[model samples]
Target: MTYTVNCSILLTELPLLERPAAAKAAGFDAVEFWWPFTASVPADAELTRFEQAITDAGVQLTGLNFNAGDMPGGDRGLVSWMGRSSEFKDNIDVVAGIGGRLGCRSFNALYGNRQDGQTPEAQDELAVQNLAAAAEGVARIGGTVLLEPVSGAPRYPLLTAEDAVRVISRVKEQTGAANIKLLADFYHLSVNGDDVAAVIEKHAKDFGHIQIADNPGRGAPGTGELPLGEWIARSRQLGYEGHIGLEYKAPAETAFAWAIRQRIAQ
Candidate 1:
């Protein structure tokens, strides 16, 4: 499997439109991002410029997230939230359009945090429904819908590969769409105390994409204790031929350099 930079986390030094070029300059041929625009349905001009920027940079957009509310703040996702269902529906076609334009085949749909009055059962019911809808929409364009296990406060529901795969199974059963797949993010699994190697061995076939970040610090590969490069190599050995997204926090200009150097050393 090849590597792709997560532009949202890696190149904050440049404007959103310019990050793809920055990734290209760093020797990456592909990039991914969370929903870059605050609006679910951004103006066409904004979309055009984003497309142009990637086209000019000659970097492929390998993955993207649908609008997940405020990412920098505490909001993890919007798709499964009760009140935000309409907002997520509004984002579906728009996200599909962008992904279709860029030839991006995978999209991450974050399962939002648990609400106070909302029972886990209700949230789960809604998540399956929303994921089914998302799957149907993206399927029209031959794209796969991704569900990731995000690590954070205790309120977040999906914290392990098992958690995410359960949800993926529900959505697939609900829609009968084979396009629903798991996003096995090793950092979150490590943070949540799951055996990452066990997850890879068991769920490699379920994975549509994979992301990595070192544990303890969530920094570049060489800066932490996790055997990230080994896991990455292991993923490939396990038959996961998707992008290994560089979704860690590290200083710009040096992050990819360090990761590449560490891979070489390994």
Candidate 2:
């Protein structure tokens, strides 16, 4: 049960390029992030700099997200959005390429919110097509594709562990791509009223990655009532040997103290 910081949320006080060093300074040797740029296909120089930043900081890039459109502006995902399918398709290789370069072996593709005019069936069909391709792209780099059940955005379809696992199953069936796996984010599942323990008990082996944040506030572990440490121990008991991503909100100054406490406790 190792831990990695989610730089996208933890260290906003620093520039994006500096977060890895900051995480390392805070006693983390590994980190993960959402798409760091607004564009899916950022310039090669930009990509190189991002990779260099991580290298210079000496922290492992453990996981990354496929470009989900406009994360700061509330666009939950782009691939499943009707007209943006092509954009999403084009970015699959870009994300995988970066992952390969960084040795990051896990990628999460968010299932976007339901559009007003599109039927759920249609959106789901498009997701299967895109995720299948995403799975293949990451597989080429010896990586795995992850499906996360994100909560807080009410319109996003995938809200529970079961919901994400359902999609993962479908993508595997449709694409014959066995690299697809679930990203079990405890905060989201608890926020959506799912039994977190039950989810871990049932699908721990099925999980490709595990992210954690306290519910109700989406903050550090002690900020809420969820038994964060207990759940993590349960995950270990169930045989999940992957990194536990610290995907919680905290100011840069205090980001890793709680995390370090948890790590020491483990």
Best by TM-score: 2
TM-score of each: 0.96, 0.96
Model 1: residues with Cα > 4 Å off, grouped in runs: 260-266
lDDT of 2 by residue, 86-203 (tens): 8998898899889888899999888899999999999999999988888888888899988888887978988888888888888888878789888999998898889999999999
Worst 10 residues of 2 by lDDT: 253-262
For each candidate, what is the lDDT? 0.87, 0.88
Scanning candidate 1 in windows of ten residues, the lowest lDDT window is: 257-266
List where candidate 2 sits over 4 angstroms from the true fold: 262-266
Candidate 1 local lDDT, 41-89, one digit each (tens): 9999989998899999999999999898887788888867998998998
- Cα error, candidate 2, residue 243 (Å): 0.5
Model 2 steric clash total: 0
Q: Candidate 2's error at 145, in angstroms? A: 0.8
Q: Count the backbone clashes (under 3 Å) in each candidate.
A: 0, 0
